[model samples]
Target: MTNWLPSLENGTGPLYIRIADEAESAIKSGTLPHGTKLPPQRDLAYDVGVTIGTISRAYALLRERGLVTGEVGRGTYVQGNSDGRVPARDPVTINYGGTRAMVPPPGKLRFDTTAAIDVGQAETVGRIMAEIASAYPGEISSYTRTLSSDWLEAGRQWLSSGNWKPEADQVLPQLGVHAGINAVVAAVSGAGDRIVCEHLTYSQVSRSANLMGRQIALVDSDQNGILPEDFERVCAREHPKAAFIMSSGQNPTLVTLPLSRRKEIVDIARKYNVWLIEDYLYGGMIDDRIPLLAELAPDRTFLLNGLSKSVAAGVRGGWVACPPHMSQRVRVTQKMVSGGLPFLLAELSARLVLSGAAGEIRSKVLTEIGEREALVRQLFAGKEFRSHPRLPFFWLKLPEPWLSGTFKQAVLDADVLIDDEDEFKPARSARVYHHVRVGFSEGRERAISTEGLKTIRRILDQSPLGTSAIV
Candidate 1:
C-alpha cells in the first residue's frame, strides 16, 4: 500500500502536506475506496520514511476535509467516494491541431515546462490598477490616449539607472516582449531578409521571425553558449540583417553567456554591421547584470525587456530602449501596433518600481529561487543536468541509454511533463542528443512533480547502457 505512495525526499514542501495530497489522490482514484481502512499511522510512516506525527497530521487533514474518518483503536477509513463535490478533472484542453494531448493538472512530482504566474504577481498588478484609478482616472475609460510623459520619463530614468542610459525620447513602451520583438524585427530586418540565431533558441523569437516572413539561420553553439568563431563565420556567410540573442539566462538550456564570450559575440556583430537584439527577459534576477550589448555597440543594438519574466505576464507591459538612430523606426512601428503603451498599467508598474516594492518583490523572488534551486540540486545531485541559482528551469542532458523521446515518454508515463529539445531546434532531422528541460517556477508543494522525477530516475536506472545516441 505504501509503495503506491511516492517518496517525498529531494522535493520542496513539508512531509505531512505531501502525504495528505497523496492520500487525497488515492481516495479520488478509488484505490482507497469508501470505507476501506487506511494503514496504521506508525506502519505507514515507517514505510514512507516520515515521522508518525506527520502521518497523524496528514490523516487529520483528510479527516478535516471529510475524505476520511477515524475510530479510536480501530484505525481510519475512507469516508465516502470524494462526496461528488470535487471538481471534475477537465484536463487542460490545448488544441494543437488535435495531435497533442491535454496536459494533466500537476500532481505531487510533475516537472513543469510551461511558465506559471501566481496570484501574488496578479495582486501586485491589481494594486497598481487601483493606484492608477485613484490617482489618475478617466484616461483608461476606453478612449485612445498616449501614455503620460511623466511615467515615460520614469522608464527612461529606470534604464539610465541600470546603465542602458537612454533618453526619455529613446525609450519606447509597448505591450510585451512579443510585440517588442515583432516591431524591432520588422523595422530592422525587412521581409525576406535573413536573421541568424543560436541553433537552439527561444521558440517565441523563432515564431516571431517566421511571422515577419524573415528566414532564420541557426548557427551551431557550444556548451558555453553560441561559439564566437561560429557566430563570426555565420555573419560572414549568411550576411544576416540582425542577430537575436538572449545574453542573460537563456531558456531551455539555462545557460548565461559569460562576459568575455559575450564581448566576442558583440564584437562579431559590430564587425559584421548586424543589428543586435538583446532579450533581457530574465534581466532583474541576476547579480552584477552585465551591460546590454546595446551599451557595447550603442549604434547597432536594440534592447527588449518586460515584466513578463520578473513580474506577472498579464501586466501586458514592456519597454524598448533602442539606439538613438533607430528611434524613429521603432516609433513608427509602435504607432502601427497599438500606438503607445497603455498608460494605466504603465503608470502602475512604474509606481511599483519607484516605491521600492519591486525590489522587495524581487527579494521574495530570490527566496523562492533559493528554495527551488536547492530542490533541484538535491534531486539531481549525481545526475547529468545543468542549472543556475536564479534560472527558472534546468537543462538535463540525459545519459546515453535514454533517447530524448524515450525519456520524455517514460517521465510522462510517471505523470511528469517536460519540454523536449526538439521544440528549440531551428531545423532538425529528428532530435540529436536527448535532453529534457524542467522548470522549477511552479513553486513548492510539487510532490507529484518530484514523484515523476523519481520515476524517471528509476526508469533510467533500469535502461540498458549505451542505448541512447551520443552527440
Candidate 2:
C-alpha cells in the first residue's frame, strides 16, 4: 500500500470531487495500479488536511465510477484502469434504408419527419438557457452524471401539463422519449425476453428492442388502437415480459385509446402479470385528458413523455415515470446505456416548465398543428384517412391498386417524402396494412405541406399507368 496524497488546491469545485478527480487521474496513469489499496480515510484526511467525511465522499464517488471498490472489513482498493474511459458496450444502431429512410431532396416538400413547427419557442428556450447559464454556471459547465432530486421534481412539474402527476421519486429525467423507452425496456426485460407492442407501433421502440436483443411480439389493433382481447391472447400465448403502448395520439396512427379501452388493457396486463410501458409522446397536443396507463397500473407501468414532439425535437428532454420499486433499476439501466441524462437540457426543460414557457409553447404548437390538420382535412375531405386534429401526422389508408410502396415512391418522385406502414411494423409481424403516415408539421410553412398534400391527392386520383417502377 502506497501512502497516497492528493493535492487539495483552492478554487476547485469541491474538496471531495477534487480528491476523486486526482485519484481517478492517478489510477489511469498507472500510478495507482489495480488492486492498490487506498489510504485509510483518517490517514488520507490528515495528510490532505481535509475532513474524514470528505475523503469518504471521494471514495464513494470513485466506487460509483467503477474506479475503486470498498470491502466490508478492508479499505478501498482501485478496481481497474478506467480513468477517462467509458464502459465498453455495443452501440445501438437502426439502419434507415427502407421506408424509414425518407429524406427528401433539398428544397423539396417534407411530410415525413413528425416534428412540431417552430412557434417562437426556440427564442424562449434560448433566453431561458441564457438565464440558466448565468444563474447556474457550474451546472451548465459540469456533467450531471446522476439525476438529482431537484431535476426529478422539475420533470414531474413538466409532466403536470399533460395531467401526469407522478411522485417525485417515481420520475426520472431521460435524454428523450426514445432513450427513455430503451432504458425502461432494458430495465424490465433481458435479451431474448418477449416484448409485445401494437401491430403498427412507433418504429423506434421496435428498433430499440431489437438492439437490446429482445424478441418483439406484435398484437393486432383496431381503429380505437390496441384491442384488449388481442393483447390478452398474445400475453397468454407468448407470456411476454412487457408491452409498449402509445396511449394518446399514437405515432403515425393518431389514435387516442379511449378510457374504457385503457382500463381493459390495464386489466389484461394485470391479469397476465406483464409490465406496461406507456408512451405519451403527443400528450401535450391532446386537449382531451385520457387516463394514462401509469395512473391505471402504477405498480407495473412505466410512462414516458418528452418535449421533442410537443416542444422541439432538438431539445431532447424527456422523463420516465417508473413504479416506485423499479425506479432505481430503471435509473441504473439509463445511466449504463446513455451515461445518464443531459443535465443542461433537463435544466432547460425545468426552466421551461417552472417559468410556464412550455405551456405557452405547447399552445402555439397545437394551434399551428390544428390549423394545418384542418387544412389537410378539408383538402382530403371524404378521403380514407385516420387522424386526430391535434396530432402532427395521420394515417392515409391507401386506395385499392395503390400499394404503400408504390404510393410512397410516386410521392417521392414528385419531390415529396412520406413514411409507409412497413417502417412501423415489427420484424416478425405477418400483418401488412397498406397505409402511409402523412405528416403536416415538417414543412416550414403550411403552403409547403399543402402543396405536398395536393400532389398526393393528384397521384391518388390518377391512374397507375406508366408507373410500373413504383410497383
Candidate 3:
C-alpha cells in the first residue's frame, strides 16, 4: 500500500489533472483501496518523471476532488476509515501552517516545528493577563487605539544588534513576525508586484505574497545564502518590488547570510528599488553578534522580530522595525490587514518584554534548545547534515535511493513528523536538494525526541527500495 502509485500512461490534459484522474479512477475501481497510504510525492515524481511540485499539484487536485485528506505536515491519506468513522474537522477559516505542525495528533512525535521551546511561560503570561484585565477593565474591553512607548522600547531592544539600534519611534509592534512580514509586503508592494526570495526559504513569506496577489520570483542560492549575481539577475528580470530574507538561522537551511553578500544584495535592491523585508525571527535568538540587514541598509530594510521563537509561541508577540519615516505606514497596513491587534495580546507582550519575564523565559528556552541540539549532534554525528549551534532543526541530505519525500513518509509511518525539502521549496520541482529538516524542539519531551531521532537514524540506515519502514 505504501508503494501505491498512479499510472500516468497515455491519457492526459494537464499533468496534475491526469494524475488526479488516475487517482480518482483507482479510488472508484477499488484498486487504490481504503486506508492505502500513497507513495510520497517526491518518490512518485521521480518514478514518473515529474517535479515534486507537479506531484504536489496532483495531490492537491485529489484533495479538491475529496479523494484525499491530511497535508504535508500530517501524512496524506485517502478519505476513508476502516472503522466506519468519519474524521471530524472544525471546517473553520484557519490559516493552516501546513509545513509547521499546530497541536499534533495523538501518538505522533512532532519534529516539524521550531515554534519556541515551552519553558512554562503560561504562568507568567496568565498572571500578567489577569492583572491587566483587573487593572483596566475598560481598556481591556475596548479596541486598542494606542501603541505604547513601552511596546516600541521592547521592540527596539529585542531587534537591536551589535552595531545597529533603531530609534524607538522606528519600531512598530506587530502581532508576530509572520504578520509583521506581511504588513511590510502590504506596505511596499501592490497586487501583481513581484517579490524575490531565495530558491529554498521559509515558504510563509512566498505563500503570504501569493495570497496577496503578489508573484514570487525565486533567486538561486548556495550553501552560504542567495547568490548575489542571481539575485541581481532576478531583480533586473523579474522587477520585484520587495524581497524577504531570513539573514540568520534561516528556517530549514540554517545558513547565516554573510556580511559581504548582505552588502551585495542591498546594492542590488537599491539599483532595482526593491524593498527588503528582513525577517529576524531566529536571527536575534541565535546570535545578536552579527550586524543586521537593517543596520547595513536601513534605508530599504524592514526588520521583523518577535517572541514566538524565543519566549512563547502562543503569546503572539511580534514587532516590525521599519526604515525611517515608514513605521507609521507599516503600522497602519498591519491594522488594516490583521484587523488590528488584540488589546490584551499587545499589552501582555509589551509587559512581558518590559518586565524582563520574557527574557527569563527566553534564557530557559535557549538552554533547552542547546541541550536538544547537543542530542542532535550526538545522534546525527556521522550523517550528512547542516545545523547551527543554536538552531532547533538540522538539514539532512539523504543517501542513494532515498528521496526526501520518501524518507519523510517512511519517518512519518514510524510516528515522527519532519519537513521534507519540498516544504521549504521556493519554486517548484525544478530544484531538489534531497534534504529534510529534522527539528527537536517540537518533540517537547527529551525522551520523545531521542526516540524520534533513533527512528530517523534507523530509516536512514535502511534504504526504502520502494517499501515503507517496518516500524
Best model number under lDDT: 3
C-alpha RMSD between model 3 and the true structure: 5.2
Candidate 2 versus the native: TM-score? 0.77
lDDT per residue, candidate 2, 43-143, as tens digits?
Answer: 88788897664676577557646678776457788785445342332233223233344455676677887776877677888898888888888877777
* 2 or 3, greater by TM-score: 3
- Candidate 3 local lDDT, 31-82, one digit each (tens): 7766767887667889889866567667755664556775544466777567
**TM-score, cand. 1:** 0.71
- lDDT (tens digit, per residue) of candidate 1 on 1-471: 223454575434656657787777877877776777788776787788875545655665566456776765577777764454333333222111111234554463445543433426666667778878887667776653555676566566445525456777777776777788778888897888888878777766766677567888777677777888988888999899998888777767766788888789888988898998887766545544677676777778887766665555566567778887787788688667556556676776677667766556656666666666677788778888887776667888887655554455445545666666755655432326577787766543555445655665666665522222100
lDDT of each: 0.66, 0.78, 0.80
Relative to the unseen true structure, what is the C-alpha lDDT of residue 466 in candidate 3, on a scale of 0 to 100? 39
Native-referenced Cα lDDT, model 1: 0.66
Query: What is the Cα-based lDDT of residue 270 in candidate 1?
Result: 82
Best-first order by TM-score: 3, 2, 1
Which 10 consecutive residues of model 3 have the lowest summed lDDT? Answer: 87-96
lDDT leaderboard ranking: 3, 2, 1
**Would you give me the overall lDDT of model 2?**
0.78
Candidate 1: misplaced stretches above 4 Å?
1-110, 114-119, 157-164, 335-340, 429-431, 443-471
